[model samples]
Target: MTSFQQLLTDLGNKSLSVLDRNIPKSAYVPLDLSVTNAALKEVDVSSASKLGEYINRHIAMNEGKVAYGGYLEKRGIYNRSDYFNQQNPETERNIHLGLDLWIAAETPIYAPLEGEVHSFQNNTNFGDYGPTIILKHIINTVEFYTLYGHLSLASIENLQIGDVFRKGEQIATLGDASINGDYAPHLHFQIIKDIQQYSGDYPGVASQKDVVFYQENCPDPNLLLRL
Candidate 1:
């Protein structure tokens, strides 16, 4: 049986671009809610260790999930409430299993490794994940996949499944409110292994009961990005 450490080592060996050096050395910055003045008007999240909790609460109220993404149900801060498994299969629920990099629209997004385009779709709707993309990657011969959501409409215009993408290759641009499911532009990234018979849209967030499945299927992206 494969072990988690082995998985981590295998993933570490995969072709991935470190976000640290991708941006200009001076331009690279930590995620600070205060920098943009959200702290002044909203909650203060300057402390790094406390950031996660702040963000989790922010999403729970603002987006209905601990992680930021498409909340299919409708029960959150946006006056929207979407409990993950309320109406979905027994397998789906509102639990967050990934880290979200919130930034402005059109932020360049790149492939983390050499992989094939597994699927793409325009998950259009209010509070939806527009222009989503999933890539299948094989590392150490173990099969797994990564998901990219809330992308610009033009991102996948000329792309197709089975197309090959190299590490650092520009895959898409961040979407604005009009096309990105109506929230601040950001990247909704998740690592997925078993898709569990879902397509175009898999649960970006799961419920507490389903946390173990997501944790195993969607390993912390920090292992790859360290972002």
Candidate 2:
């Protein structure tokens, strides 16, 4: 593992949640939206409502409140959106590079670690992150970032750069399909070792050709989430 990843791994065996703390870890169940999942063969998730239904059913069947997991997962959900459709296997950006927490709209999202707002904005595009926040965190002299995407519009209305947020503080609430890129309400959490020049936005998906670079730059959020 890289030093940055090691730093993240060393944060805590079980880190804090971006979700509510009252909700125990047990309530955070794993979800598989990868293309390899045979279950999604006939089911369509490109539609926000259809995906929401699938997620709701998954959460209910698993007896969980939040369905999480998707780091490095190859999904077909992006295919339906012209914004993400490239029709090229090698260059198509369908591989999710972040961990997603599937939950209801307006659900509160917290900071997993102490950090300041690096930037926040409303990314308007089909199948894009609506209101997003990027937090800059420095630990043991190593600087990194955490991204919170698909947030409610109100989340960034009054936000400013460098705003401080203590770990576990309420940073933003989840957004609904009408605003959050036409998808089920969920928090797209990602750990970035090097954010480069990105401010309020960063690539959350990777093409096969660029997966290697992204895999290193963006480690599995589970390293910090541990959910």
Q: Which regions in candidate 2 have their CA more than 4 angstroms from the true location? A: none
lDDT of model 1 at residue 29?
Answer: 35
TM-score of each: 0.70, 0.97
Alpha carbon lDDT of each predicted model:
0.63, 0.91
TM-score for model 1?
0.70
Candidate 2 residue pairs that clash: none
Tens digits of lDDT, candidate 1, 108-140: 888888788988999975556889998888877
Provide C-alpha RMSD values for all models, in order: 8.2, 1.0
Q: Find the candidate with the highest lDDT and give its number.
A: 2
